[model samples]
Target: MQHSIPPGGRVSGFRLAKLLGEWRRRGARHGSADLAAAVRMLVLDGRLPAGTRLPAEREMAEALPVSRTMVSAALDQLRAEGLVASRRGAGTWISLPSGGALVGGADTPLVGSSMVDFARAAPPAIPGLLPAFDAVRARLPEQLVDHGYYEHGVPELRRRIAQRFEARGLPTSPDQILVTSGAQHALALVLRMLTGPGDRVLVEQPSYPNALDAIKAMSAIPVPVAMTDTGWDLPGIAAALRQAAPRMAYVVPDFHNPTAHRMDAETRAGLADLARRARTPLVVDETIVELDLDGDPLDGPPPVASYADDLVVTLGSASKSHWAGLRIGWIRASTEVVHRLVSSRTALDLGSAVLDQMVLAELLTEPESGLADRRRHLAGQRDVLMAGLREHLPQWRFDRPGGGLSVWCELDAPVSTRIAVVAQNHGMRLAPGARFGAHGGFERWLRLPFVLPPDVLREAVRRLGLVAAAVSGGGSVPHQEVEVPVA
Candidate 1:
């Protein structure tokens, strides 16, 4: 089974530290108040779920750039607010306010410890991944002499990625590629390099939440263009570009997240034309392109770079196609843009892990068969999930996504958040549609990922059915409340 954090489980201190990204600046005070505010926000927003253990004071101080005194003070503040608890032998864990007034409604159920988490959209590693490591191990000795720090990535990996793009009709040179930790990191580099605070950035209405977060983190204003149930609103996007003239427009053209709507070739060309005229760089995310299960013998849609190579910057990842643990993703852009990213990358990290890049290179050199195998697996899982939703929860309407990991499902009532709240109480975790919508749209929808195995998907759907029923019943079900003892 894929690893998931149980509702009352504790994630590693390192993981918690990462979740507290750039939190020091949120409050005017750089010490305890700011740290406390950040932790409180995380707990309230459900990112740091209740019952997750916070790192020890010293550990947190080491993980973040704060003193142990500040960490202790922050914990004290959280304790006073009932957002944290401590046991004699146990470390501090997150807690919701008593009565759940700050988070959900007072009657809202505390999420059970046995909840089946559906928040992650990643799939398990493919079968060949283990053996691929041995392939890389054999070549490790050949490169031991060098210092092993490569900001532009291992040259061989860059060449292989370029060839992969070339095969897809987007001719690319190795210099055009800059490998990063993952797609999110690539996006961060792009956002930092291309846009500044107060600059307008265009994004899909219900786009990737992390992408929106990244834009917000940079303090760039996001101009959303609505993407309907059918597909991209071309005219609407055109209008946004014309009016906003955004510094950058980010789009997931192939197998978009939440909504698995792929932009047609004509629409891709139109977007390219528009971006070209506006002199705006189009950031096309192709992380899910290889996931197409439309039953076509051909490969997925051509890269947006093919539409206008000069105007479009493309992001691709081995995470979606092969495995996420590898942490290998790249940016394919103009050589000039690549140079800028390379120069600015040291501010983020020196480079990606070299060994992971080598493994991805091997995978890329011979990926068609492995890709076909994965597609078959995902297709089977998708079908099983769809069948379960149909049989168990027919009222939850969804489009059969042609490609990508999740299906954007619509509900009759605008209670997606309420359903998620209730589902959390009933041992199921859900990514509410409101999480995807920037302006509180998609309130009637949910993004259900079918990447899990058939049996697991069926059981998850069954649990979700219980939540759906409780939601549709229009009566308050008494929730079993877990009272957390304050620190």
Candidate 2:
């Protein structure tokens, strides 16, 4: 693939410090190595993209409150690794992150590679998927009679999606649905329609990594409200909505990503009222709501849109629910909003893949038990993961998530970035907690996906234990350059 260099942009010293959160390890004498490791992780994660200019050592030292000598040492290490480059007059900037191919855990094997993809919280296609495809193939003859373009999605698929919402206790119509390439694509359209550069978007403190990337890419600021131990902090969200007066609020109320917290009905009602009062549309992401492991998704709390339909823009995807290969997601909102989105969407693409939409529509027609098998499989894998964690790394702690695909593990030490840096050698790819945070500070947290097979999950956890132990022991792991994919 051809690449275009991003225009050089300089990051502020204080901003850089925030991005490199909690870099120093506990009881560590020298912070230089830790600082370098943190920076390396950020660059590899695309947090600090190539062509991004860095603050001078003295400025960075003032922001970090570390000695200039330590700052110089960290820069030296990064420069030696070629992760960063500096010139006499040009100062320092990030080098392009390329070369050194590493295997990734793509569900369908995107390439010839081998590694446990612990970062992506996605599962393979369900057992019913191929049958759904065959069903679509049988009906394909008539579908070929007309032009395949569906700006508002195939009508039957849209109706099926609306029916799912009704099952979840939300009154949705086919008019409210506008299908797109994926949830990420749906989000981009919403952002383009509702916001402009410098607009504020309310978001959870630790959000979906790609969502955060989308918000930043749009040049809109993210106003984050921290999550409590139990779930969302409604008061905090209300305060942000009032003070920030953001253009819109992006939320994952159902089986929230990484943390896997589902909002209660009462809280959902309160949030809807808050958004209504503030006139801020809540962009609710229910991409993984169908993956409810504890109970039926329909039996779960009512869809947040039910509370304030006009104040909500719901994004749904078949990626996590049925298959990522489908790449089909849709937006549900007021008909006016849907129409506006369609007007703006033509600049992006014509419509989602017709065949994929048909497959999902077919799957949606199946009984609720169609997804029961998926939940059971995930629950069993979750059990395998928790058991492995207890056996190999008992010190790590995480709450049993009732739904969603991952376990949010809290490390005994502030070494998430360290653990990730070392895990590559163990043939495991892990997403550090910093990826979830808005400005990067969850050093003690890591999100571990249980989407892999039972045996793979068990082995992944075992390797993770070794990685955690190595980092905690303060033994230096040799640098192994590889790409870190964010899902």
- Model 2, stretches more than 4 Å misplaced? 1-113, 477-483
Candidate 2 lDDT score relative to the true structure: 0.82
Assess candidate 1 and give its TM-score to the true structure: 0.74
lDDT of 1 by residue, 370-433 (tens): 6776787678778888998999888878889888888788888887777877876666667777
Best by lDDT: 2
Count clashing pairs, candidate 1: 0
Where in model 1 is the C-alpha error above 4 Å?
1-114, 296-298, 477-487
Best by TM-score: 2
Would you estimate the TM-scores of all the predictions? 0.74, 0.76
